[model samples]
Target: MTEFTEPEAKLEALLGIINSSARQAIAEYKKTGHGVPSADATTFHPLDLATDTLALKKATRLLEGAYHQLSAILAPPQHTVMNFVFNYNWACTNVALRAHIADVLEQHPEGLSVDRIADAVGLDESKTARILRALSLMGCFKEVKRDVFANTRLSLILKSANNTGCYAHYHSRDVSKYAGVLYETMIDEEFSRSHEVDKAPRVFACRKEGMEESFWEMMKNDDERRDIFHRGLIGHSEMMGTSSVLHQYNWGDVSSVVDVGSGIGAFSMPLAKMFPHLRITNHDLPEVMVQARNAWEENVPEALLDGRVEFVPINFFEDIPVAGKDVYYLRHIIHNWPDAEATTILHNIRKAMGPNSVVLIPSSSTHSKNLAVAPEPMLPNFGAGSHRVYQIDLTMWFLLNSKERTLDEFKTIAAAAGLALTQVYDLVETMVIEFRIAQN
Candidate 1:
């Protein structure tokens, strides 16, 4: 057996990953000419604001993967297993987001006393202190002085304005409820065998609230929830560093692109900003189209002034996209549906493709490429470092009866839609898979 496959080499392998990955991250920071970020940094590093984070994420993947593996390997099994159950990190983060603790703390650049902070947000002093202390342990907040909390770089992400905060709010509030019922959904007669969106744990949990409609249907009907949800998608992209695709993909060669199921032009706006020559189309339901236009006007107004962008409302399962575009880009779309619906969306796009048109599914491309191959002696996909991805895979199951797919799983669906997978670009956060119309 290879050393990587041997049980004895695990610890040694982890240490190597930790050392090398940490060095890689240090190099990324130094290359930025900003040195490395301090643990107590109060604001974002310049790299944090950069659209390209391929190097940073690459280093992080290894660093995160190794440390988590080492922890799991060395820590007592009881500590690790109970961790799956006794975790209150989410609950504490929920409190921080809901209370707008980050916003309040932002006013006190130096720091704020727990009692005063609690009074400012109108929560009990001791309870606020407890939650802050808990999250502080995880680096979300800093205890500048005993019972005095300050915003850290991580805490800034929890601010009311940040998209990651919105993402967290939705997940912590709604997704958590659905997750609570995951076991019940697994064993229940009606939901157990169904892969339909309506049968999701989310719908089951909210059965009494009359959440009988599919996730998309419900989103379509509710304006407020839909707005928050779409904004969260933008936040989702930022947190995932998906904007790197603009630099990674060969957009310069493509004349035009369509963002299918586009939510407020999250991907397309940045694409348009970065590549001014490429014509862009944003497609979604009618309401979301209105949103996309407004967002484009606000964020990519230059594109609007030049009349280079178009908003086309689409129901992807039934409607073919605007035809003959160089690319039909679906960012974070297919993963929200089960095989049947996902295939239908692809089929619809397939119908729109001219001979040269390519359909791009950017979210799941890494599995088919080198990006997902962990360093030897580590679990492929980078065990603990990839913890979030696995958690998100479960999140899809809980919320929509959908999932993240392995390459083969994604290809099976693509084949069913009469498309052929043509290329794969492994962006650090997600993979961008390219497909073309199948040759019969």
Candidate 2:
């Protein structure tokens, strides 16, 4: 056995990891009976649309992590460092999404000339051509012929109808602005040390643009944006591969679930569909409750007929959820507030817990003060494998001045609410942390 303490042995170990993880990923694709996707393919592979992607995500995480580690070591340092700032894919993607470039291209699948594409989208021809070419380099759009472009599998998500595209749209349009002022916010006296909602980097950025409404207030007042934001949540779920919880968890044993701060029942809708036995309560603000009912009625009206799901309006910081639920699920909720308010939310839930009731938090582990480390010869948190997780942690900070809590931080807040951590499910991209009421 080669000792990884030496640099050469460590490099070899990473190479082995990259190889094995890649093969594992290939096997997953083959198991689907559709084989692997070609780089130049214009259509999505069957596996790309799958919901339960835990195994594939696992392999991808290691493959990405190990390969990036290897490249950083093997390649010149300047090349790697410059690549960070050189990335303008998000900007280019923003242009394509706003222009509905994919939607325009979809009508002419053979290929559309850049001039025609720009005309259809009402954009300048030369500028649009440049954007398409940049994205084509990344396989998002394909240059089928000189100055002509076609939608690739990667570009499909950018179409107006794709929910994941909505998620990308929000990030590219809104979050990118917030990110641009990260340095300014850090140095500003008012926002530098504040962790409150009003002091977030988004607030700082918006204030500079002469808009001062809080994030939720803006969402509530703007109907169009609220709709896009809700759809974006569905997109967020897909991108994170979070639906894996549907298969990974022991939902069969559970009967009732209270979806705390559940925005339009994204998680519970699928849960209710998969396990018809679950009695679900979706608790959110009064306005959101309206949207929830409409969503369920449109999507899963049968669930409502049997009384399998109920919509209850709540202000979680002050109001308590219904009593004695089998599970109080908070998906991407706790990370939206500062520690004190986060404790209040949990404490309120703790009040409604029965002896066997559990609280589940499906979150990115990147924000924790102490993440579970990877095995030897790998960067502890799986490096680039956890790229999105780390970026999400920063996103929370940018939008809400909050963060994904560390395990110790989670334990501390749970303790404050008379709850204790019982189990942790490493769902690759995000971990589902289970908490129960503390026994005195």
User: TM-score for every candidate vs. truth?
Assistant: 0.96, 0.96
Against the reference, the lDDT scores of all candidates come to 0.86, 0.90
Clashes of 1: 3
Candidate number of the best lDDT: 2
| Candidate 2 TM-score, C-alpha based | 0.96
Q: In candidate 2, how many Å is residue 185 off?
A: 1.2
Clashing pairs in 1: 362-432, 365-431, 366-431
The residue-by-residue lDDT of candidate 1 on 4-95, one tens digit each, is: 56666878878988998999999999998999999999999999888899888888988988898888888999998998898888889989
**Candidate 2 displacement at residue 103 in angstroms:** 1.2
Off by over 4 Å in 2: 367-375
List candidate 1 stretches off by more than 4 Å.
Answer: 4-8, 365-371
- In candidate 2, position 417 carries an lDDT of 96
